[model samples]
Target: MTTLPSSTRRKLGLVIDLDTCVGCHACVVSCKGWNTENYGAPLSDQDPYGAEPSGTFLNRVHSYEVQPDDGTAQLVHFPKSCLHCDNAPCVTVCPTGASYKRQEDGIVLVNEDTCIGCGLCAWACPYGAREMDAAAKVMKKCTLCVDRIYNENLPEVDRVPACVRTCPSNARHFGDLADPDSDVSQLVAARGGMDLMPEQGTAPVNKYLPPRLKDRLDRTEEIDVLAPFLAPVTDQPKGFLGWLDKALDKI
Candidate 1:
């Protein structure tokens, strides 16, 4: 039988559209579902029914309220996940060689068998993408559904990652960033895409398109225009001598 082509040269990454994402939590939920059941042990939750319950998750959506100078608030739902940085610091920090970037596809992955549970890679990740699977004592993170994406048995539509397949708003795209003609690249070019925390200089392969400006809400109407110019009124006396004379006049 002929040998299958290796995945070493392919470039893989995620594209998130801030303009279209409604912060519905579909991607987050779907990611949890796929990862929990498929790879290593289900994300390993601690104290599920307790007061401070938490679980390991590769993807999380954060909600931010941005307040403008006029006291207007905008609710921005930003999803936080591994951007799979081109210069991934996590890979270099791993002493066991468990964390590595695929030369063929540019996908960062952990070799579960070789991982020693040192937790160094997790500390190297600034996005908090890597989590220790407490049950397995190994680090876990987004694989980008590697198993599903390359499965020859699945239909073309089903070949993408579970998270991308389940996104209802179509806010996520997965493809090769190396090729400019790819759909993800086109979308990024059409929109002014940017990397989050570029100063960190991880060179995140993933890109986020900022949201379009919404209709302006008028806050000027809420403030009384004459309030600053209007004088303060008081029933009390002024200066001592003038007050006495004014009181005598009034009486």
Candidate 2:
């Protein structure tokens, strides 16, 4: 069986803002495209155009209609992925030592070459993050886009996970969570981020910011279509033209 590192030097993970995610599946599509083209073996599809279509995917968003005690029912988009836990059950459960956690960044990964497709790691994972690839016949999980993140050839802006870069609503953020000053850490602190399932004692590195209650989400009143644009742009004249108008009046 595999074993986890005592500790990682860096806790590089994601900070997902639940309130901002729009559930458009942009991240999901980008992850599929990027990982298939740039990373490991292609995510296989079974009868994609047939009766039942099933495929492997690293990141997925599940929408739930959650009714808060104080607030009305609202649809929450919960994105799930590998948490790279300090006590990863999947790593320890791998009989062939194919599953391992990185000591440098705490990113849990499966060695596909050594993997026997036993599905033990997938069963061990609590978040349901691992998937069985039909074509590769191995367990596939989020690698944090390791190939793209550290590639020197790619532009700096494209260094993050494809899910983070392609999130249209900017719901996903990737950075070193171990760094107290990192943007992801600060965002978590400010937003009161929480782990996926703290009771499981996995010590998941990735965090999720809770959705803030908004009065607008539940209000049944009809919105005035022109209410916002009705407001005046400025009491004073607009920029350059305004200055010219004033100068001409003075003349």
Candidate 3:
């Protein structure tokens, strides 16, 4: 089994806002497209034209309907991927050195060449983030767009995860979470961000901004106080990449 790094220099991860996400699946598609050509391995698809079709994707969005005590039901869109835990069990379970976390940026990645496709990593991961690539016979997961984010060939402003860049709702954010002053950290602090499953003791780097309750409140005074902070959905930028650039500038 491989041992995790004693400490990582920076915890680079994602901050997903459940409040603003619209369940568009734009981020899912963008992640598939960018990762198929750029990273660890080609995201494979089986039986594309056949009756049963299955494909590999690094990011996925799920929707759930929750009813509050007041009987108001809300549909929440949840985007999930590798959380890149500080004490990743997947890495520790890997018999080979293929599964390892980068000490520099804390991105967990699999070395396809060294991986034996034993599925131990997948079994060890509590989040179900690991996927077996049928074509390569190797396990794969989100690398936080490590190749693109650090690529010197790309423009400085374009150096972010594909999902973050393509999100139409501006719900996904990327930055060094270890830095208290980073935009992502500030956003997490302001929005009361939370870890997915804290009981697992993985200490996941990613955080989720819970949906705001102001919209559900019937009190006019409560709504008035939150109105100033909430931007009108209609007023959001329509152009996909254009809106991303604007949001990145703020971060």
Question: By lDDT, is 1 or 2 better?
Answer: 2
Q: In model 1, what lDDT does residue 89 have?
A: 85
Model 2 bad stretches (over 4 Å): 216-251
In model 3, what are the clashing residue pairs, if there are any?
A: none
- Could you give candidate 2's per-residue lDDT for residues 28-64 as a string of tens digits? 9999998887666789989999999999999888999
Assess candidate 2 and give its lDDT.
Answer: 0.90
lDDT of each: 0.82, 0.90, 0.92
Number of the predicted model whose lDDT against the real structure is largest: 3
lDDT of 1 at 33: 85
Clashing pairs in 1: 8-104, 8-105, 9-104, 10-104, 10-105
TM-score-best of 2 and 3 = 3
**Candidate number with greatest TM-score:** 3
| Cα lDDT of model 1 by residue, 59-176, tens digit | 8888888887764688878877878788888988888788888777777888888999999988988889899987888999898888888889989999887778998888889998
| lDDT (Cα, 0-100) at 81 in candidate 1 | 80
RMSD of 2: 11.4
